[model samples]
Target chain A: MSAEEWEKVLWKTQSYPDNHIPARYFLASLRKNPNFRPYTYWPLVLASCAITQHLATIYIFLAVFVRLKECSLDPRILVWITVACFIGGYLAWELLNCSRSDTARRNANGTKTLKSSILVFLALMALSPVLKTLTAATSSDSIWALSAFLFMLNALLADYSPAKLGGQVRERLTSVLSMNAAISSSVVLGSRLSDGLAVFALILFSVQAFALFPMLRQRLQATLTIFQALLTLLLSLLSICLTASLSATVSCIYAATLVAVTFVAPGILVWAQKYKNEIRGPWDVAVPKVN
Target chain B: MDPLSIAMITDFFHPNVGGVENHIFMLSANLLRKGHKVIVITHSHDPDRVGIRWMLPSLKVYYLPYPTIASSATLPNYFTFLPYFRTIILREHITLIHAHASLSPLGQEGILHAHLMGVRTVFTDHSLFGFEDAASILTNKLLEAALKNVDAVICVSHIGRENTVLRGQLFEKTDEDPSTVAVSGNVFVIPNALVADQFKPSQIPDVSQPSSKPLCVTIVVISRLAYRKGIDLLVAAAPRICSAFPNVKFVIGGTGPKLNELLQMREKHLLQDRIELLGPVRHSDVRDVLVRGSIFLNTSLTESFGIAILEAACAGLYVVSTRVGGVPEILPEDMISFANPEEDDVFRAMSEAITIVSQGKHDPWNAHKRVKGFYDWFQVAERTEKVYESVIKSDQRDLWTRIRRTMELGPFAGLIYVVILIVNCVFFLILEWSIPREDLHFVWMHWNRDYFIELSQKEARKTSFI
Candidate 1:
């Protein structure tokens, strides 16, 4: 619209010609749709791997639980298997941590401390009996309800990504909800068992799977090559298979799920995200200084 | 021509007080006065005023119950809001969707649905965002996506426009036809408007005259005590400024997470004698606070319009503010003193403003006239109405006359989306075929949407509009 046209009608129609485009005007100056970057294959795949690995680990843990429940597997044998895997994973992680001379780049700082782990172990040990008998007085239904609530809390609170990672806190919190439920379920089951040794074994497994494994997974991502990751995944799958032999149907189901999880889940998630294509515009509030 | 019907979209609105909320209220009220049909779409906070409640004659507000994950922003449940938003538009016959604030999920969701429904989308940026930081980057990306098909962007100042263009990466490498994604010229600079009549300075006789003792000058620092507000600078400068000038006393107001820090400073400096912490005075009482002071101190790191400064100016207080964001453009040099967002600079500026008042360089009468001349809701309403017309006309020129008119559409909207979707699907299919869903364990949904909806809806409909 022309200056005359705009001026003539602060409220009424003007004398300016129709189709009189204002040159270099504010609206015209805006690039209608801008700054959209297409996602490449490799980065998308890498991002998916974070989800993939998490699902695979969850499956492996479920497979272990199934084996323990059905096969009547020797507690000593399962403990040994878990210890060997932990030691190997630890060695691999330490080497990776050492190789990355730039400590700043490495995410595995202060987190993998033996002291912290020991302290956590002591704390958990101290709390387990209290945790076991503490809720015993409550009705079974309420206990169930409370356990479910605690699991949800754990899921909400768990940080999947370190501060350096790209995912939002909310996203990571979502990822851990399943893990929280599984661990809490195991704890409830452990308390139900008559054997204290069985309870201890289950508790140790829960700690490894929930608390310790996520940190290891992050380190593995940071430190390992594709070949090494594949190799580790293969080994983890083998252990899952061995563990599965102890429990037939449930373990078989879990093992199959692990394969599907490692391959399909990430790809599906990426696909969904790509299709949705979140469009953000100026309507969003500007993050202001609190000052 | 008839006044345009506008759907003002914001996450925050009346009952919730903030810059964006106040902006929407004032803008809508003024637009309504100009005979425009203005309805607001925001998430419900109050109960009784939930869903559709008429705020004024010809001004209706539709409150949507979207889950707020943090602060007041909806969870960006994009497609979830489309149906209701569409219904609201159809019923109200909303010609334009004018969204305020760039980081709000509800605002972005409104724009997306508005675009899908073939309505004109105009976004107003109320604050500046930096290029750096993860949160800002994500926000910028979301803003970029939202702006992809928007008609035009309204910035409060030239600086805000520049920041938006740069941070949004609106300009990048051009296509073969030299077609850019978007141009910077689409940014309209419309400064904030104030109800000038409401801010008319009270004629208190003997207020500005020389007293028996040296004139007691009050420096007002009224804002949330937060890092962004540069409250630390105020906390640091309060003691020095007060100690340097015994005649001057500090009246600091507003509260935030940094209130404890301010209190600590007050306690440490023994400033109970010199400084007064008013502790979060109401918006209605802002003028009462301002009129008590000779100089208004705004030690902010960033500001969109510095509406508080404008309000202070309207109250005839000399604005001593940091020259950051849109603040530098708000007032002329004589009526205000520009300071860097630092303790030394703020202190210096405060001293300078005091000196200028002492020397009678700035007449209170002249300051009032300048303020009245600069900002008024009527003028703002007119300019905003012009924006509405121009934006509507622009949309008429750009929007497809037919649903499948590819000629008017660009690559980003049509072909690229199809290709990207196909490619992603192909990859997903391959993964699925190679892998298996039966083998994959499904994770249950975390939060119950239905439960939250019922609760929020009940709260929205039940609460009184206080």
Candidate 2:
């Protein structure tokens, strides 16, 4: 007749009606957001920096392509700038690897890096003529459209997480596809250039920006947040500067995207935390604890 | 109270042996015994067993022509079931619709269109689902929509009731406090029951005792070899138990995707001599398998109502089970052993149970008698009849109220269900116009239980006389 008389057990026959809701015990075990941890605005913005960096790389590649097409920059100078970037990036990598305990392994890895870089450099030099004519029969409009589509795929499929295994590259299927897509897009776009040297410079630069830079960025994000923020700022500014004189519309779009990614998206996510509700109770499939 | 015609609708029924299927059959048979007219509606099975059929005790079944998509469940299409449901409800003069299971599309659709025939609706949710996984979230929303205007909701256990209340959104803002929500007054807890006669303890003693082992204890496990059944815990604990107690053996019955793991464990531990695997046990032979052992081990990670556990206890096996949903409420502490769903805890519980069985501290006959007094199918039917009486007396929800309540599903799903509700009404109107009720055939010859008994007796006597 009263709330105290009702028990949660089903064995004993009770005086109350079957549908009678126990005023005190109904849904007493129901829990909301039992394991929820609201994401902070700063950390989310920091995470979004990965995506922003990828977008900036895409815009920078486009700016470089445009400059080469108009003959505003020499292919030899672009090639020299790429070699300087490779050396600077390698020095930064060595500085990061100094914390590792193995000195002998680092010496061996140094030789291996030198050998692979030399091999890739000479290979590009040898294949530039073939790469230049790879898509000669295709229309310039088709090339532009194809490269745009491939770049979008590259940006969407690129791995944005910080390296979990201390900068060792995880060959995820989508990430490999993204690398392939970026390389192929640059190859077709380089076909539009006037000479084999321009195509060689573009191929080398694409390898650095799309392949090597993402690996270094992942390591930087893992090790130093300040470096990641500084790199994101540098890339966004350089991308805007590279596109400003060529097209004002492109520069405005790039600036708006960087602002939205760094500030607006995280703020929206932080505000949306109020709506989080995850129901947990005894009915959930118990995760069995076993050896 | 006058007899009421009830239709038991579900996607799972006879020919598909499962918890839902058996629960429907048993509840329908018990209700028929209580002088209420009962019928079952389900989807057609493969190769055979279609159209109208009769079960024992004159229970009628109508298998609608719809192929099952997965696990004997039909794809949920809101409009396609209305025609068949309308005709059946009209011909059978079903006063109330009792649908079973949350994932059964046939049951949910029956509840959706039951109102068009002016019949009340009752849903019996037999399983528990969490609100986390994508499949659970989708099915919970669908359940919420179907139960928006249901007259009564029944769950099998205390935890199951709470689970279904949240999953089906069976709550309403209180009259005194409009902001705070309270559980709706229609949800009930009617525990599933078994026929104690079927699970009677073994009459003959162990005739073929392995003479090599002086004293041996056979631990029995009868469940689908699946992760949800906590087979990993069994596989992990079985070898340890074999090593710890050289006199102990295992008899595992049933087969599934995880059967290979159990097989590999047996082979790896060199427990091939101690463990016996019987694949795909028939329900009729469950008692035979259970009676061969002294202890029944259940390692289910999640269960709503463990009817199998009760059946084991009735078969006089000392029960050792994971302290999961509703398992604790089935038997008292002294009768059954409990474990956390952990490998070490299960090994500990098994050790205790084996010691108890070896010392003859647990009486199989006493356990059997106690479980018999605990649950019975007739008692479940009597309780379900009370639910039906209350539902019949209660006022049915009107269309406006139903639409208003349904809009609480969500911003998007709410509108979608509202559209389903409106379109269902429009389709009902079309059916009423196209096939007028005056031209349809109404079932005048109802199945009478007394007449059926008399006729069967006569046939039996004639066969014996011949």
Candidate 3:
């Protein structure tokens, strides 16, 4: 039979057998990698900068905890630094809002932020005494292990997307989970402190690092790729310097991890693009477009 | 062709009342009529449906006592199925095993074990699946391993054939062009066929009857309310259709997870009177529902074969379906209307169908006659018999060839499945020793219509004499 005589319809009885492979266009509707968009090395590295920033935050939090735990750093000085970082972060946030020309809700947001900050400060002061002795019964080794695992969980589950900013950016469940994990790690580590003030200072620093810093980072991610890369570099270097003062081996490990996340991982991804075979066709479940 | 002792192995069968279940029953009945023996092997339904049973016209069903994980599919335990499978195949004298539905673990395991019994194997994929989803990726690998040594593959439609070919990796390098691959020649496209007489058009009254009120052009939708069935499109389009055409009404049947959404659409739009929901209509009542409306609307996002649309068309209702998988290949262009699976497009198609229906351009009885000739179960049986005959004539793959073919799956998965293959053979050997073929009860006699009737009459006369 001629190839033209073989129509794809099922209702009719064509002379060809049921197993006939058409001489032309067999399995013609199959579309391989139809929506393929290959990733470039540099662009993927830049996109993965969010992961680098998240890892830096986690490492910096650990360094702060280690300093407070060993009683080597003054809690009062740490609290003063937290206050200064809070003021500076607030100014930067205000600047971001002004540049986006979102002044209509500025007064409302400022008052709300002021109320929440004061409430958290007073609450932390009240909770410091209880938190300092919260896990006194648990061994120090268990506390260290738990905090390490929790920090890893926070890094793994954190929301790394750039926020649109200037709108009600609804928090994702994963981001909430990530925040809780980091705060829980901070509490367990703070409970290992010798004094209540150190616990208070560490808790305050954690609230800034885990909660406030992520929102600021998301807004900053929208600014420029160069800006994000520079911030990632600064944070990673600070984490390495702080860890080096404590231990050389830990600092080297952190540096290697930072380099892997920022450069090596993205290179592997760019190389792995050749293996991506996304077979799409009419057989895929259609996403109905509704008004 | 000589008679084949064929075992229809699937996880779906009677009392389940689904497309696969009905297809197996109908095909088995038709094959029995054609003088071949057919037996169904499926997981037993809950509450008292276990062991061997018989349907009309000598379609024997063996409801194996196996629990299903979800959607009536047994867990794919590679070796455990061999003991039961071996005993059934040996006793029933099954020369070939035909498995249905890719999701059925019983079917895949049957294909994996059939070669060990020295029986030829044929597999039919009844649905289409995307290759990108994680579930599809894992299941497709499993399917690839299961289909590696099967004698033949059957698909319900052309699109389904493509999906199964890719999912099963049923392709080889072409003879002329070694660099290019083609779908294997053994893969066949045998479409699902509906019994048209069951969907015969009723004697619907025309405008000439002059009843108390003028008849309205009703649109009927009969499908399970599921996301894949595109119920969201219906919920979006129903209100707009209601306000656009006041005389047009809807009768939606079948119930599923999306039922609440359809109910909410009806309530929010205040279309309670305009839209009627017949919760869970039986298969026998589908034709009655189809005959109530002049237009049959199907809004499925993905369909392997639109059997519902064919049933509607056979019942004389003009079909207006979302132009989806294998649906376009089912009927002639004039008999149905197609729309992209979008709200505006479906609304457009629905309005056009309404106009066509109201203007009397589409005739129901004429459509019934046309569709009646399009598909028949007996014809499906004959074509399937051709596949079975060819499969039996083909050489069965040896254990070494099966191992080599299984090795082609990939490095990681291929090694894993190869281990499974060897382990399965060892287990079969163990079963052969424990439950030897000599001790197994063989089915020496089958149901013969004439002999059974004569035996029954003789018993009746003896009872009367007593």
Candidate 4:
């Protein structure tokens, strides 16, 4: 094609067909992978730790339930252990907050947190007897099926992202649904237990697992990187050991999931980057410059 | 050459006032004047009227009784429209199926069904969609599916062509070999046109006449008050513009959900006297509104083609538009004052345009002549006719090539498309068996020979200089 013929001016009529694509100008404006930000192995692995922590929490919850069912651990002892862990987590969170420069801006509200925690404990204690008999009339088969479905809902709906982008109503809804499902699952499981004390210990452990634990873990992960990775490893080991004490098959599945989530998924993502071809050009809708 | 019968399918048509609707109406009318039998298929707009209605002597519209989804788009039922669409195709003897607007499900489905029936298809994209959002992703995937086997794809601007190719995933990427990055083979850049005669400057007040008293420069904005139109920028820039040029006034037209926010902004700035919000002017009154202003301001954050700017220019008004999408490609540098889609930039550009117009530095008459010569519906129809001719002349793809192209979309999408095509074939058989070809009568129509003779004479005059 002649140099003069290659111009894309619209004012003058040309002999070529309107859909005639000249080879020189064909894909001339295409820009491949314009917004591709390179991903490293470590950051992706760190992000995947959120999934690992969630799965580990689920495994630990199931393990505690099984142990309670077998009466392998005392209900009072289990309650004491959960209380000690909650207080320790609170102190560690406060220490982390004190070390941070934004503590004043955050307005650490220790008294409010304490008050809410005490209120929750008292409420759970009062509700245990009711929860124990709540699903007694329902058959064991239906109880197991309902609890299983709720647990699945919790797992599917949990927010696993590291950064909490503010005010996404859909994300907030999913997170709320996940919490509600987990709490409902715990309530149903508590009703399955014969002892009211066992029900209380199970509810308290669930409150720690579903509600306070995620906030503490998120804080730790945001502030201390090494501590977050170490905590992930520690939780994985604990979940595996606990699951093994119950069933070998469950422990094996947990180990396989841990390896797959922590190592295989990130590897797949990094590998798939090779096939990423997002074309951007002058034709794209320009991002408006905000004042 | 024998004139081709054409079917224009879209959900947007008359009763809906927008750029795409006007483009379709004008193009179809021009095609009819050129002696081609034209029929438009769109969803029913009013309950009182639904079947075949003739808008012009040669132009007919078939409003399919289908439920509308969001924003006047029909609900996407992949195979539901095939029987009726095929009947229209057969009855009208339509050789070409021209689908408008990527977002319109009726248009996309028309293209797909036309292709399945072995009829040539052309798709025209009118808007720009980004790839980052989920909605765009889904829409793009659907576009990819529809355009995979289409004979030709037409975009309204060069940038629009690029966007269509990208969304359709019609390019290949290779670092080692630039030649391997196969460009979209059939994508075309055909800029949208306006009815230049209708937008003549003589319809309203002339911008060139200097007043004895200090005259307030009227800056007109006519668009749907939507977020994508950059109404927020207009809201932010209006007060600053009013303050910067004390003799400047604003006349805004069109209505949308964002009109309340603009009203609130106007009240907060206390410039109700300076700003006149004339909500939703009819399409016929657009030129009347445009000639009342010395300058036209468009604050659209994204646009495929700024047809409003062209109409404003045709009305002999200087244009100030955001330098996003295909807005920059529509007018010459002298006729337009370009700004980034920012409030401050819009305010600055508006102030600059006001100064330029007040100083009599730009000639509105020359701008009007330039726009009139640049965009004409007859020219658009002729170009579209060429596309149709080329598509009809091209060799038909065998079944395997069609299936392979459809399967290239992705595993799941490929599965869905394959199933759709299979069902489409079965449905085609069912249609053929139930509704025998002899039973469907061809709608006999004739065109005014004098009209074609006049159009041919005009065409000859247009090409005489070339």
Candidate 5:
């Protein structure tokens, strides 16, 4: 038997006391590009549009607040503008729903129905008084801390770019943009009134945006275009600014903060997220498909 | 020797309650009972001795203050932990680094650092990972790199061995040396053992024969309602199973994203009367819950060792578990009914188990005996210690050079052997002919091997005296 045979090195048999070292030691046992899938540039650009719209809306809201603070404008105009925008969004959503009734039907099959959702929303709205009163027992500092914690949680769990129905590009873009707008709407409403109604509205809108919209947005992204998204972003920002300028100094500050937030936050967040997870180790629980 | 200096490294231990954590604690305690110096290294949790903690006599634990990454896994800092690890090893005179949990950074880092420091390393893969998912990919890569110089790799079950071989890519061939990477130690099937005394038939609820009244079969489910746990399967099967076995009741414990889905199932099936959704319970209370139920239901998609099912068997509850991971190997066929990780299969198996129990086809005592035979912490500790000793003995100087030469053929292959080794060695030979040998830095060995040998002999004598 050849003591220096390569097989001896491979099996490391003590029977063969050959000093010959084994080859292929650097071939570390690991999956080569296990879950890697390349991204399409259009999809990436379309996904970025949600952030763009959010920033534009924030800018508009600040501009309105600035006008109100400087020109001593009325808050009624701001409210009217908000209502008008909500109505416009609602109408647009309905139109989209009608156009894609078949797709909506498919999505709704294994999902919650509109009727059940409405009932749940109404129930939550009724319970808002209790939720508002919940913080009454606690101190303001505690509530602040709690809200901040919840916001951080929300940010962490929330899906940034959701998929579309049947991988439609247009539909996916539309849904994501709509979801972001919905989140913006919730933030504004959340900041506006401290009462039960405001709280309920914020909760409702948050669920709609974060939970439901992502699924719809994923469907929409497979269909929508970058141009349409840009147009939507521009128009929404202009409308928000036109209305927001009529509000008070506090509202203006809130508006300005939103603008400041959207512009710088995304860049900062993406940068920070890079170092968020340093998942080293072959020992990690492998994601298996239980067949 | 010298009290058998050992370090048990894991991500989830003590304060973090789960099957893996409980296993670690039990193993540590048993090792300590066997007169070994055991220390647990884990990420620091708030309000729990952040640095060093002593659980029991001769059981010293070091809680490293590291940021938790995801689900208790600490953010992996490879080189940053060198200084602390080095100091700990030196202070404790650690002879073996026995790491637990596949994904735990503490375990991975501990094993890697320990090997570099010339200490024996043994890694116990407590969980099974598939060859899919981004997390698994990264984990596998890191695990591969870390296990490069590992003394031995322990799998909980035979299936786990196959998975380790496949996903870990343990078998390969190369030009410099084409061979199956002979692990210095064996890939032993060390199943997770439970404390049989604590979990016994006496501890469980009285499962006398089917009463005159409706047969009250409480199906116990204590698992995190995650996708991996097959919570969705449980939701799909629970109602149907309950409907089929009218007298049977369900108690689902633990919490996750799938909690809502389970609740919806309960409501949809109108199983509120029969099924109880207990979100989460204290680890101490798990045995109590297991005993209350006549049958234990495990719907986990994958597992290295089904510790819960083993615990249930110890509790004398007829085990009905999904045939995933190392569950099948853990128990004899008579003790438990295995089901595929599907809703239909799980429901069917559960129904069959209920039927059999109602008919009094099997004896719970037999299960208790089998479980006791199969799973005992003392056996695990003894076997583990043997592995440690074997590895320590195998870590000779000759093996190190051979391993390094073998590893060269893996990544930076031909270029290294030809240029670095052959050419350099030739150059050195020629230079020796031209110039005189130069003085080099003389590094002293940290621990005297003779001292450890002497200590081991003394300990053997002490054991004989006892």
Candidate 6:
């Protein structure tokens, strides 16, 4: 058809149907995957490392529970190890802070972190006895169920996106919910312990695992890339070993999950890239130009 | 060509008034004029008004008592409307189901049920949706499912067609060649039309009579006061417009959630006397509202075939609209002053429009003539009829061929499509068994020859009056 023949004019009716598109003019304006961003393997693997660290934290908490049940780990030794690690972590954090250009702001942040840590430690110590009896009437079956549910919630709701890798607190409700559930499960489980010292140890361990650990991990990943990767590998291996000490079946499951998340998931994502044909064109709602 | 018994399904219709409602009503009326039987199916907004009512002798509207959930859209209970919709189809002897608006649950459901009943379906998309947001994502997915088996998809503009194709995932892909982009053959671009006779330049006062006092250049804005309409931009630019031109005023119409913000802005600027908020105007009185202003300002952030601007042009008002979505496709540069959807840009465009109107260089009567010649409902109806014809012809293909076409979407989507098809087929069979087609009575009120003669005579009288 000629250009004039294709021109849609209201005054003069044409011989062709209203919807007739000449072969040459069909989809002349279509643009496919104009803004598509392809994924790289290493970045995806790096992002999934957050999930590995989160799982390792859960593993350490469970290992502490198993040791407490067997009476194999002394509360006194646990307290001394926790205090020494806290002091060492604090010193390393301060040294890292000193490298920043804003010394005054770094010092303020250091003071705030120290003050908050001391306050949390004292609060957990004082609340241990109360927590020991708080869930006494609740059945052991219910407590175990609740703990499982909370742990699953933490795993599902955890933010695994690289956008949160900037050390900025992008705390979604899901993140807060997951953290609270993890702490509350520890408290409920701690209540089942016979001695207040054991309860105190459990609560303190949870505070460090659920709260302080994520911040340090995020900071490490943001500031030191190679060290973060090494830490992820070390944590994954330690968690696997601890799970194996608990039960062979549990260890096998943990290893399988680790492989699926870190390796299999990225492979699937890369395989699916061929189908990513998101077409954009002038027909899209114009993103309004703002001056 | 045989006249089709068509059912126009939507969640928006009379008792509610907006662009989509007006478009459906006008299109139905014009289709009826062309000797087609048209019935509208919409969710009832008013409790007192629930059953069928005749809007015209031929145009019957059935307001089903389905509770509206949000934004006048019915609750999207997938299969709840099937039996009732099936009953209506049988009673109306509907050969074609023409659904309006993608967001309407009734529209989507009607299309699904119509396809199961072996009737042709055409969906007209009236708005543009983004691909980024969660709500848009879910809506696009649902649209894709609904449109998977639809015979044809009609869009009001080329951009709208593109958006619909993308949202519906209606592109055909070849395995060997990834670069080739072929859109689905069912999509069509058909711009909305205006009732030119209703909105005529003769409604305006004679331009030859010069007034002793200079007329205040009133800029009219007629749109639902929604955030997407860019009412915030209008509110922000109002003060600047008022301060820049001494003899400038605004006449705003339509009611919505953003009314209070507009009132607050008016009070803060204390331009109560300058800006006239008409609250809402009936569709019949839109031309009256347009004639009161020298310029019509459309600060809509997005539009798909701005029918209000076309109406304004038909009523002899110079238009100033945001160059977003399909707004840029509606008019020539001389008829409208384009602006970005921002405060400064809109303010500048309004000021420029005021200057141009005041200069009296371009004749508004010419704009009216051009718009009238460009958009006529009869032409729109004829084009729409051609689409119906083509789809009805293609609907003759065997069931296996249709199923294969749907399965080509993707493996997972194909599985879902097959399941939906099976469920729909079962439900349709149950409905047929329970309510036998012989039990349903077909209404032939529109088939009367006198009605057609009277309609043509009325149309002729309207043209002669104009």
What is the lDDT for A34 in model 1? 54
Q: What is the lDDT of residue A171 in candidate 4?
A: 39
* Model 2 lDDT tens row, A76-161: 99999999999999999888878864899999999999999999999999999999998999999999899989998999999998
Docking class of 3: high
Compared with the true structure, model 2 gives a TM-score of: 0.96
lDDT score, candidate 4, position B18: 83
Tens digits of per-residue lDDT for model 4, A30-141: 7779778978888999988988998899889989998998899899999999999999998887786675446554565776787899999999999899999998899989
Residue B269, candidate 4: alpha-carbon lDDT: 88
Model 5 lDDT tens row, B302-397: 777777777888887888887665666676677789887666778789989988777766556667776677666787777777777667778443
lDDT of each: 0.66, 0.91, 0.90, 0.84, 0.63, 0.80
Give me the displacement of residue B351 in model 3, in angstroms. 1.4
Alpha-carbon shift of residue B350 in model 5 (angstroms): 1.8
* Candidate 2, CAPRI quality class derived from DockQ: medium
Off by over 4 Å in 5: A1-170, A174-291, B1-3, B172-185, B202-214, B396-466
Residue pairs in steric clash, candidate 6?
A283-B159
Q: Which 10-residue window of candidate 1 chain B scores lowest in summed lDDT? A: B400-409
- DockQ of each candidate's interface versus the true one? 0.02, 0.80, 0.84, 0.37, 0.03, 0.26
Once fitted onto the true fold, the runs of candidate 4 whose alpha carbons sit more than 4 angstroms away are A1-6, A14-17, A20-29, A100-116, A156-176, B115-118, B169-181, B202-214, B398-401, B410-412, B445-466
For candidate 2, lDDT tens digit of each residue in B289-337? 9989889999999999999898999999999999888888788888789
On a 0 to 100 scale, what is the lDDT of residue B199 in model 4? 81
Q: Report the CAPRI category for model 6.
A: acceptable
Rate residue B409 of model 1 by lDDT: 32
